[model samples]
Target: MSRKEQIEKTATALFKSKGFSATSMRDLANALGIEAASIYSHIKSKEEILQRVCFNMAREFFEAIDAVEAKEGNATDRLKRAIAAHVNVLTQNTEASAVFLHEWRHLSEPMHGTYLSLRDKYEARFREIIRSGMNNGEFTVPDEKFAALTILSSLNWIHTWYKPEGKMTPAEIAHNLTEMLLNGLTSSKQALHDTYSHLNTP
Candidate 1:
């Protein structure tokens, strides 16, 4: 990788671990095995690195949503695809994802506002999908907003605990999460029981 790419990658890892507020330029430099002064030769400031990580992640999420929308599918299938895309992005870019999830608050002024706006837009895409599913009778949620928030909340924190070497691949985890969210645990259990009862009838 080029020095700029290397600096951003190292900074992202540090921001993910020590947080944007706690991590210093020297910390990033140490991680990169360079003099702190050399970091500025590639990037302007620590905030610039944070901006790169945060905005790249935001761009990725929006692109995923756009891809899902461009496809010809019902809301249920589209929603599943969205979930898979989200999980794939997070798992594939764990360090940047962590900083995007946790370190964004440290962003200054216009950046902080911009991040929030982008995040709201990202969230609205999920809300729109849920609302569409409800309208089409594919989903029966009492509150579209709440359901969307719940699903996003569950999916957003995967970076905190997800291991790259885990037995489950990102796609499998995405599929299972989609199933559980789209069809509740108890509802699936009840459906299985009813199916068995019907089969056993004389």
Candidate 2:
């Protein structure tokens, strides 16, 4: 990697482990074995790296979701793809994903506002999938908003404990999670009970 890429990569790691507030440019430089001032040549400020990591990861989510949404399927299948896409994005780069999911709060104004806008927009897209399912009689949530938030909440929390070297691969986690979440949202109570009971099996 080039010097700039190296700096950004290291910054992502620091942001994940130390958080944006605690990680300093000097600390980043020390991690690279360079003088503090030298990093200024490639980075204007630490928040610049924050913007890059958060926005880039956001782009990955958009790209994955866009492709899944455009495919031929019912809302149920589309949501399955959306969940898989989300899990893939989180698992592919846990460090950057951790920083993206957790550290964007430290961003400055304008960028922070922009990130919030993008965040709401992204959540809205996910909600739309749930709404679509409700309209098509595939999902039976009383409140799509609450259901979407709950589903995304559970999915987003995966990053905190997910380990690539753990027993479950990304696809397995995605499939199992989709099964559990879908079981909850399905319109048929009998099917929901059967699927959920099976999901709880060892």
* Residue 168 miss distance in model 1 (angstroms): 0.6
Residue lDDT tens for model 2, 15-99: 9999999998889999999999999999899999999999999999999999998899988898999999999999999999999
Prediction 1 global C-alpha lDDT:
0.88
Of the candidates shown, which would achieve the greatest TM-score relative to the real structure? 2
Model 2's lDDT to the true fold?
0.91
**TM-score per candidate, in order?**
0.89, 0.91
Q: Could you give candidate 1's per-residue lDDT for residues 93-124 as a string of tens digits? A: 88899999888998999999999999999889
Total clashing pairs for each candidate: 0, 0
Off by over 4 Å in 2: 187-202
Candidate 1, poorest ten consecutive residues by summed lDDT: 184-193
Candidate 1 has a TM-score of 0.89
